[model samples]
Target: MDMASALASLSRLQHPFSRQRSGWLLAGTLALGAIPALAQSTSGVDGVWSGTAQSNGQQVPLKLEIHGEGDHLQAALLNGKQRSASSSGSYTDGHLALQFDYYANSIDASLKDGTLTGTFSSRGRSIPFTAQRNTKAEPSSPNPVNIGGDWEVEVKSSKNESAWTLHVKQSGPNVEAVIQRIDGDTGSLFGEWRNGQYEVSHFTAAGPSYAVLRPQADGTLQLVTPAHGGTTQTWTARRPQQARAAGLASPDDPLQHTRLSNPSQPLAFSGKTLDGKTISNTDPDFKGKVVIVSIGGSWCPNCHDEAPLLESLYRKYHDRGLDIVELSFEEENQLANPTRLRAMIQQLGLTYQVLLTGTPDQLNEKITGVEHLDSWPTTFFIGRDGRVKAIHTGFAGPATGDAHRDLEKETDALVKKLLS
Candidate 1:
């Protein structure tokens, strides 16, 4: 079946929340109406707006913060524990436009009656969204619980279990946090404490998520997440005495220990490039070269974090026999695949090749040649002889701070060993 058709069929079997999250994988266009002034309010669009965005039968709360005015305006999107700034924003002719260059997403909406109505577009899909200007004063906390420090958190759900490092800072009731998962950081989540509970949220073109932390009797915090379709998951976290680095696996560690199975096998796969050219593991371009095979997808936020580092490594070591190939397991839209890939490559200034593999399920079956893959952006390091040297699963993006630096140092050392 064609990729688009396959994806459509797969969506029917997935949970409603999953479908809503994956809607951006489809191909479509956003139709925005002309902006007309409301008779009630002539105030410029500068301030904080809070409301819920309904998409794919799910409602996610969002906050839009606009600063400055006119062409000099800047904007930030907030959901739960995520915040992303616009590449550029402008308010002109009663119209609002915000461009997120990182995800190839855009928001075009019109303001009327203290309400902003528009469509959020990513890849090729468009979802309707609305926001109402918040007029209430910022809430203050008389006795705010200090959650500053590093915490080791575990999120367990029926479908998945994962670990995360939550770094929290609080000044009075103002709270700022960053969640470092195996994949990447959750960006900056800004919110305030209320009634002894800490709350924060972030929204982006991809989707929305939030967290509500309530102190437990054992000194740990319970993170409650309300999932779409009436499901709820809780993450429990405790402050560790010492802060540790982020990332699932360290680069200095032995690669064999990180693999789930089949550590000694040479990587093998054949796929078409984004340009429709067929390529294989045995291609002449990769012969005798130290290869880094990146298994990821455009729809993955963690993959977005890892792309720039890969691009840097490629540019620095390509002449020294380093070759990188991104084996992307994209959404089932074949037509949208290239567009998303190209956007990512261009945004990161990546020169390495990207091969369009099938869906995550297909790629897991074909590439791993064993059990299903466990994570997004699993990187395979292949020696000059084309045998797998090590497999590093998951990525700790820059949000991990020192952890990210340590990863770079380890990667550089490993490359030196392979080249020597």
Candidate 2:
């Protein structure tokens, strides 16, 4: 189906926690009142439903719990094993209208007796979901959107800061693409797209890096920026209107930039906190805490998003002896001065000790070079004994909510192990 319609179908899926968040739900319900509800039928699908979905040749079992009042239909996916991604739509007429974040369109599924026995389309793939209603069954989750094909994507950074042109091809569930730099030389990228989300391992002429994209329902895609840690913008592709091979490639040249690692390299420092508190590598106070040293700036949008999450983690685990030090890269040259650094920390409401690193050039020289740093908001986790644990570069933000979810899961596991 078309992108708009595909998105609508995915939007109909809902989260189980909706009722608990009444304010947000109320606003959404009011805004979405224009959409039609499920069709009025003698089909007794007004309860819990469950089934398996084999879409685009991938099979995933789904459990759906529908709460219907009169003409309105609200359903939640009962399975938490899948990600928390959900949709909202009304069942009206014979069509099941739904919307999802990963599609640029909504989907209209023709259902017979709560079964998706008719045609359905999402992310340019039109397939049938042979759904059957089970009174005692839970709902099944089909994959989100399927952006499985050859695509020519051009990413223009906001305000012409930078741009990347990609010639991406999807083979089955795997993603293999070549990105052309501004000078026309090509670098490679690899990953996969399932349910309309992209987990790409981006490499310039450099080494391994990462990127995630969320396809919207209106055929427009949301580019989850790793730099700013939040939703950035919407992009729509103009597919060639002519008949071409489903997995075809164009001869156009792609844009390129310096290759940087997705997870940037670690930087060492021997500095004090932003509040003029003496904290050096030899400090006895940090002898046994899971420490995190960060390279970030308050002016950076990506850093703004990451700082809050870091603050959340600190608050949650600081009592358990989690020590965090932020190395600030302010616009001023005297950034290493603690008095100036504390102002930046106060402005961001960051309770952690922030040390002023040197100038950006000096900062680059002191830490690993900036060329190795793909984006801002870089983090390096340290073990209790002070050795490096992991380096996470770039912030995917709430736009690619799933990526952040995975990050939280990883962090929790590590923290739990340390606590234990």
Candidate 3:
């Protein structure tokens, strides 16, 4: 694999959740019902095709099979992992139109020679993909982690704190095990694994997701995404001689005090929504219910990881009179504009109210009264009476292995306790 293809392949490994390698998931299941022969003639969509789907920065290769008999057409999408996504629709004029039950999912282009270029909609979001004719193809290389084994790992960061852990496990392709976070929290080793990697979807009282580990080679793990385009970080871990400290305290934990304890201050600015609606401490909705203010930019990958989780939580608890506000510090000036903000809200199918936060300097003043913040994706959870319940400083993306486990545990306990 050249640099570009290697990069693309790496992307696929990261986001197996959405992309389909073969005939997996949505692309495999989406099929257009029926179309008029005249419509097909005009659309000119009669062929086999191939494509890839990209979300944030992760990419998944896909295969599309389109068989159109006159105006009647049938389309099938095969993802990188052999997941199937199929859809059916008719052509009108020169447009090959198809509909996915999910909104954000879209089909990008019409059929062409042995390929179709388009996107699939899911969770009110769209990731571009393509498909090609079905043929016997080579299977993907086996994922690094063995069913049972000890692996060496390390993480070093000059921009942020550096840490290491021994991921002890017993399982295969997917493993079941525990990861020792260098900056461990309470010696609370979360839960058991089902497949191999920690089952982040489930929860235990002890902790959040990091209980499992995804094996990484001794080489540097380069991080890239739409948000931090040119940013890169090198990380590696060594195998431990014996069982290491489980609840080893992070020396830097004390420095985190300032940002984690105080919550009376607001991270958002006083402004109207994109539609020119006013929002502030004086708003009627602000008077009651726990208000959660999130500082993020649409371009951030960490935000992408946390946004969906936040949106899900907000919807689950909003009816209980819970108030959650998003303060987006978008890099796009257009996104900063109220009109563009409105368009983004519609385009992204966001149901929460998002305000345009000022510059980084201004944001410093907004959250200054509390503690200090360094990252772009910080969340401050307020209580029903409008008091700060918790101040979560950063995101633990799915890639982090164990960060997500701890986050969910903290977030769930806090949210449920407040609701009760």
lDDT of each: 0.64, 0.45, 0.44
Local error of candidate 3 at residue 122 (angstroms): 18
Which tens-of-lDDT digit does each residue in 356-383 have in candidate 3?
6665446566555655465556777777
On TM-score, the stronger of 1 and 2 is 1
User: Between the candidate structures 1 and 2, which one is better when assessed by lDDT?
Assistant: 1
Number of the top-ranking candidate, with TM-score as the measure: 1
The C-alpha stretches of model 1 lying farther than 4 A from their native spots are 1-108, 119-129, 132-137, 155-163, 241-260, 334-337, 370-372
The regions of model 2 sitting more than 4 angstroms off are 1-267, 333-344, 368-371
The residue-by-residue lDDT of candidate 1 on 182-280, one tens digit each, is 445564555677777866654665555456767787778887656555555677777654213334321222233245356566788777887789988
lDDT of 2 by residue, 324-405 (tens): 8877665553454334334334434678777666554455665653343434556777777666656666554432344446
**Candidate 2 residue-wise lDDT at 283:** 77
Best by lDDT: 1
State the number of backbone clashes in model 3. 82
Give the worst 10-residue stretch by lDDT in candidate 3.
200-209
Q: What would the TM-scores of all predictions be?
A: 0.74, 0.39, 0.52
Span of 10 residues, lowest total lDDT, candidate 2:
22-31
Model 3 lDDT at residue 357: 61
Estimate the lDDT of model 3. 0.44
